[model samples]
Target: MDCDSKTFTYIWEVNLDEFDRVSNLYSPPFSSWNGSVEEPWQLQFYPHGKMSIASSCLALFIVHRKLHHVEMDYTLMLINQKDENETLSVDKHSTFENSEDGFGPGPCIDDDRLDSPPSEGIYDPDRGFLVDGKIKIGVRIPTDPIPIKRKVDNMVSFTWDLSLDRYKAVPNEEDLLSPKFQTINNGEKNTWQIQVYPNGVVPELEGFLSLFLVHRGKDAITTQFEISLVNQDPTKSYRYTMEDTFSHDLNGWGEREVIGRRYLTNNTGFVFGDNVRFEVRIPLDDVSINKLEKEQAIVPFVWEVPLADMTSPTGEYLLSPKFMTWNSDESDTWQIQLFPNGIKSEKKQFVAAYLVHRGVKKVDTSFSLFISNQNEENTETVTMENVKFKYDLHGWGANAMVKRSDLEDPEKGFLFDGKKIKIGVQLATDHIPLKKTDSVMVPYTWEVKVEDLKLGTGKYLLSPNITTWNGQNKETWQVQLYPNGLSTEDNKQVSLFIAHRGDNEVTSRWSVSVVNKDPKKTESRTGTNLFGYDLQGWGSRTFIQGSKLRDESEGFIFDGKVKIGVELPSDNITLSIDNECPVIKEAPACEKCPAVVDSPVTKATPAGNPYDSPRPSPAGNPYGSPRPSPAPINASLHNLYRELKLKTPDGSEFSINHIMSFESIEKLISNLMRLSGSSSNYQPSISSYKHID
Candidate 1:
């Protein structure tokens, strides 16, 4: 049977009575060919089961009768003679060397199940596998050569003896190499040799023996072999087995510490007559020199597009000519996508660029994109390391490469001849694993100048968002300045905070500083906290007093501008998702600048002393009209309050008698009305309070 060309099946029927009479039986030999080699095979059976499974189960095996090596995938089945559909089967892929008679699933079927009733098992006298006193067995096998690029090689062993006395005289720097030997694999000739280092090549193993298998061929090869130090009693030999790839850059792979030099020299079994015999064996048919080689060469691709072509009104993007990372066309193809105007929400703000894979194969690559500037040193470049490009995610890039404005700015010199832009991509053709390091403390600083700081509206002044990196993760952060303080501060102080605007929560140690003319006076506040969507901003609400900050002598204000600096130590920062973040209210908008507002009386007055009357502001009040003083406290209720302090719902406190603002008096009256209803003894008429217009 030329089974290598197609699927082959054979059926053998045996009489159970005869099978039981003979302890062991073999079917007639059948001829099968794999490639050009002819192999004779037979089916072996043990009716009462094999040695270990005797009388408990049946044993079946496919036996090879010739001394040939072949790898095959086969299926063995015990047919239910009564139903056919109810069969017991086992499938396996195995390598067979005629040195061993055969391979099989020992104790193929349980005797109890094989002889059970038809309803409960596969065998029964009238309606199961044992019908008519016979059982049918079948085998299906594909005799084709193993599906590999290279032909399988038979087990081959080579032995070489090293003279320990001679090696002891050799210098540690020298290697003892066995004579080169040739082998043929898949019709290709190759050379290989063994190298033994008396003193290990690496420092850690200097006192040990090092053994390696080196491929002398210029091409790459993958091999599976065993290296053993032959002992006087062969069974006691010390052996090491491994599979590895050998290439031009790495032509050998083995253990640097095979055995301690002293131990090997003292063992009589290993060192016989001052010589140690080392044997190298390719132990399986699949061990061969694979011919397919990996291409590590990198190729550069450049594309120049006219600025007008990218900015044209017709299309959102333009694709560059396709190119590959290798010289051959079979290599993965890629193209550069130039979004003259960016993508999605980033349109018109940034000049986006991406590397698009044009091939079906997934590629692991390290690629860099470059945007050329007139000054070669100032060219903008972005690199993505250890990235993968596949069907699901075929492209990746920065939406904000160089800002569109910056690219078009004549002074920036990004445009060549005021008409074209040059973009280049360098791709690595092969993948190399990257080594990881421990967390490192990286520091970053950002500073911005606020012009007309007091004139800015909204709840706070926001600095431009800056992007920062911690390892492979990136985040956007912005500095927020509340010149008038938060609501709780009551416009008496300036507040400074940093907000994380990224989707992920991060923990970082950060500091915000208000620059002063005198270095010694620079006011800075530091804190470590986890910032996220729920608690977006963190800092001091009383960063600096409004009076001191605005005082000309304090030097906090320079040229009507304030310089704010923020520093972040990213050593401990890590990103994570908070699936259950709570909703937090945003800060209220600033009604007016706190610097111009009159600071409300926050201190308590001496007992029995009259409160200070209101004074008009020279600059005029921004909050409607000036406020009148409050009425005297009711005489009947005077004993109930000595140093009266009224608290608001938001937790701000004020002295009732000294309250000058219209807003504060209204809150006091409201509290009084609510208190009067709750307690009869504290009742006070509305006439006791005065409101200012």
Candidate 2:
């Protein structure tokens, strides 16, 4: 094979701002095979410089990604950003076979300097090093030029039916409920009940269906469950999940507008044989920790300066890298370019610098840029905060950062032995956007069903036998039912709630309902209500709070059992199919015969709407106010996160779900995509990324 045609290479930048934040900091290891939390090939810098048994110089090590003990060639470059075309660079290339013995350029070229003095030219500015107190570092990795055949992911689905006529029959009444509740139990011996209101009881939520999960067990067991309102027609299903720790004080969780009522009652889509199928699933496992806590942490981004790059040999004016550090927010990248050989005043002996936005749109932010001398004897520190920053493809800040007379003094420590310097940045916000560079939202059908639900007259709390996946289609959700009347201040009313497991922010729209066992009547189930607009994680509003539900005249309960359901009407997955990778994979169900599940739903509520109020308190659950329901999800790759669970080149299993940020998402994907051979039960749904506590 031709060497150039078979080898693939990728380039990235590494910032060394955290060089001095150490009581005991050293270089991190990297690998070409196994990847680490940092990157495939990692870089570490020592401010005081480093010396091997044979060489002496400022040390920057290239460690193999930890655990990745593979033989490979590596290189590190010192680039001058001043000139886009003709700047020179200092590069180091070598090969290593073990992680325990990580390698970088080191000082192999200056091995004779083992006995040199502190004033040596190896890391000194007089030798074309450290461009304006900063350096640009980059790396290249190889990949297989050939592609693999595409394959399809395993497809799983469920179906059930719901008959709505068994409940109350009141057209003009404010609220309606089942004359009796449906009781169910789980494998753990916990009991629960399901309640539904055809017409909402809340003043503003009057037109929607209101569903609830009611806990009636003796123990404080946490439950997980899934419920879906399957459409009878060939449309998508609406789904809802709950992963929760429901105790006596905090027992229930729910949502409104799981789906619209027109589809179920009038045969718009959900009605089939005058009956709509509803499903319930309680799987027997817990979602992974990465899935449970989908939100990752961001921080103070920092970069370092190598005196060798202080003067742009090409007279251009910068020495900053291209990548942002630990950036997860969809926010744009703000950069700092240092100009040692002053921009406008080359004759005035001044150091110039500018800040620019690498992103496309206009951005407003405040940052703190710290420039301090490495020498403790010199108290010279340059600090700027709350500095107004607004920039586009152009730039801002001074053309000359400081007068040459100020940073070059021998005793200043800004230059240790007149060789190196230090600098870093800290920004102030976390706002991720909806669209991304890579990843597309594909469609699929994720469904499950539960049957033989015998809601005898007595009090009962039915829960799924095992935990279920809430949003990801894994086992992360549950349902609670109250067959007997639930306790309230004045009257007896059946109650219910939909529960999900994790505590991450969830943007969802699903349907829940009471299926009328009788198919003769036309108007049967409750109308779908919307959730996540105001009350984030979990959603609930009283469908029948007052004494009106007890009326024997309304024909509330016609029987002892009513099937319930939930589904996702429009769910799009964010996936990146090269469209060129020859690997053969399973065709997405959304194509010719897609399973109708979730869809991107948008419904905003006014201040006076039931959607605006806190979930009403249950007579049994002592927690007076409503609390949020957590859903377990992979935080990174907002789309198709589960696909990242694969062993890295470092021989260790890695999961990107917890590290979903701009840096990791872009840098890790290439390696991760190559490492993964397993597929995921990926369900797609658009989220607002809001935290509804």
Candidate 3:
């Protein structure tokens, strides 16, 4: 009826036979009938429930059992004004004719009423029942007889009442019972439309038709499908059978959208507890009828976590042990502390000793700490924050602990006194480990408290340049030369030598001397003009000159071409050469000076040391070649000027005398005999005047 698509609603029933020679007939329109007794054919005109007395009692009980062999019994009815709700009723409103006096066809019939007479006035209304009002006996029924009725024109209908609106269920076939389903944690899907609807529409079914999904209750779950066909007719070829038979053809559900994934567990839940109930079992080997002929049923989706909130499971967030350190201070090294109401692990009780000596112990100790919230005017010496701790001492003794591997070189002074007690000692072996030594403007004696002597006394200066250089020593240039006084109120610390005979980058360009001695001309600016030697090339900007006693400031610290020298000075000794070149003085030990060649407590005259014989052979071996007139031996000379003791731009006192002179040996033989002319008019004049004698 209009279950929406086509037409296939049916229900039929038939049962009735009681003599009249219809002989156990209940169909084929009463398989022949008859009533005997010489044509006593008025079975009282039966038409009780109509249909022409149910086809005239199926034609007079098949002509009274084919002329009285006596076996008539019948029942038949039909209705089809397009299935007029399929109405057919029989039970006891029927027809039968058996005769031989067991006369059985009652109701609207030939009843030999052994106490029955409900209707006998049809006048002549029944040859048996009817013969032509057209409702012959075609049995079709079902229009609500309380066989549990609730509207049955059937193309789809079933209800045991669970009210519907589910989250999963629905799968069925044939007879169209289907409504069993599943999908909990998701599975066993398909059926948004496997539509085999000649009587269900959905692309309106055509060729094959086979659908199923059994397991009406207790846990049945099986589904394996892969068929696609959303539309139809592409030269049609639909096949499909899940778990077995080989069907699966599908042409249309292509551009993808029917949905289906399959595979279920927990046996598909219905019972096995947790209150499950998910059904769906379409296994006609999954499905066929040419894969649902013109296809349309699909269902598959999974992603569920709501079994009513299920409960319990989560994790992540760790951080253990990190870093730690400690050594003595008892209680197993103070266990681990950060203190001030947050870290502190407790257990330590006491330990703060120190004083281990391996030789001559004099580490000079002191300890008294305090930092309980220090706040000296918001103190800051460039973000000054100190409190680093890490002191480990384990010097077992016997001197293996010398530089025992730089015990954490903070320039070797190790300390930690924020305080919980730490008195000190292990340091001396030539100390040098006091860092940052407190400051408020400095009066450093290295920690001697009383609010640190209230600060202020810091001026410090001790710079004497040249830290080291020995490219083949050269007696480090006669062992001495001094002068490093440029401040600290000039306490004049002198021992200088920026000497250099060029090596190592040209002896770093030496020359720097001092001892200007002209203090208002008391005379002694000996050779080599008043100091100056600054020659820093390779890019300019550096110059100063007082003509050579050498103090050339490219920031003076060169050690080349030998200069700064001074080792004691009294009676008379001054040889200041700052470099105008030629000035190599050695004189000053007079009284005929020449016997002190090497002495530091003697032993250096070798090569036949007879006192190194020089003047001895110079007396008679005047012929030992080259002694033409030797007599001036110990001359005592002076006049080696080279001055400039400052003040001279009209401020008087800036002498520049003879500047250089050194000839003796009788004025070097009287200027070599007046250049060898002995001029009295050219020599021999004594002989030419012999007559006057």
Index of the highest-lDDT prediction:
1
Judged by whole-model lDDT over C-alpha atoms, candidate 1 comes out at 0.56
Better of 1 and 3 by lDDT: 1
At residue 241, candidate 2 shows an lDDT of 56
Q: Candidate 1's residue-wise lDDT over 234-254, tens digit each?
A: 533545566667786327766
Following a full C-alpha superposition, what root-mean-square deviation does model 2 have from the true structure?
37.5
Runs in model 1 with CA error above 4 Å? 1-298, 313-315, 327-329, 359-362, 375-377, 391-393, 429-693
Candidate 1 to native Cα RMSD, angstroms? 30.5
Residue 677, model 3: lDDT of 52
Error of 2 at 402 (Å): 2.8
Write candidate 3's Cα lDDT for 387-483 as tens digits.
2222211111111111212222233332123222111111111111221111111110111112211211111111111222223332111211212
Predicted candidate 3: what Cα RMSD to the true structure?
A: 49.5
What value of lDDT does candidate 2 attain over all alpha carbons? Answer: 0.37
Off by over 4 Å in 3: 1-489, 492-495, 501-505, 508-586, 590-666, 669-693
